[model samples]
Target: MSDSQRFPVAAHALAYMAHKGAFSPAQAAPSALLAASVPTNPVVVRRVTALLAKAGLIATRPGATGGSWLLRQPEDIRLDEVLKAVNGCAHIGSPPAGAKGCPISEHIPRQVGKALTAADEAATEALSKITIADLLDENPVSLAAYTPHASCPVAA
Candidate 1:
């Protein structure tokens, strides 16, 4: 997955778990189940989940019945927290090395970096107002219960 996609995948996984009521180990959702909802490979889900686990958003277990579950309620898991947890560097590429003796090239990189940093901060601020619960509240349906012709226009 691209670095940019990490945030969405992480958010979706958390919302899915929350929507499915997977709040504890006994109700944990397996990577395959999460993968089905994401329409991606289970390995990809595992990789993303590892980052979430490291961020203390979720917990995972290994072996036959191994799976993952949220460590906190959805309402408490802000989108900013999730984004940071995944560290999805959306479109903030490494700046080119400035050319020697070229004033424009030397200063442009720094200016561009500042702009990118500001944009990232703005995004975090916007997301901080949202939470996994807010996402679930917007859709309010689990993938298991989702339909192409659902009442929600977004889903359709």
Candidate 2:
């Protein structure tokens, strides 16, 4: 998947897990199932899930019955946390090193870097106000309990 898709995909995965009450290994959501909801390849979902697992946002097990489960509640998961968990670069490229003996090159990189930092801060602040639960607010699924036999809602 493209770098830009990491955050959105992560958010969707978490929301899906929450919506389906996948809160434990018994109720875990498989990567293939998650991919079906995103309409993307399972590999892409696995890649994003790996990052989420690393960030402690979710846990995973490998096997026929294995899948992923949330490490925290949906209401407790902020979008900024998801963004950081996936570590998406926000499609913002780094400034190249300033050319030697070129004043403009040196000045421009610093200015651009500052602007990018500010933009990132602004984005994090905005995302902080939103949570995975917020994403599910429209449908209002009951996330209070986990169901071991929760029927698969998306075909994989």
TM-score of 2: 0.82
- Compute the lDDT of residue 124 as modeled in candidate 1: 80
Candidate 2 residues 15-110, lDDT tens each? 999999999999999999999998789889999999999999999998788889999999899888999999864557778888998999979999
* TM per candidate: 0.85, 0.82
Error of 1 at 153 (Å): 13
Model 2 residue runs over 4 Å out of place are 96-99, 139-156
**Model 1 ranges with Cα > 4 A deviation:** 92-94, 139-155
lDDT of 1 by residue, 47-121 (tens): 999999999999999767989999999989988898889876546676788998999999999988988898888
How does model 1 score by TM-score? Answer: 0.85
Screening candidate 2 with a backbone cut-off below 3 angstroms (N, C-alpha, C), the clashing residue pairs are: none
RMSD of each: 5.8, 8.3
Give me the overall lDDT of model 2: 0.86
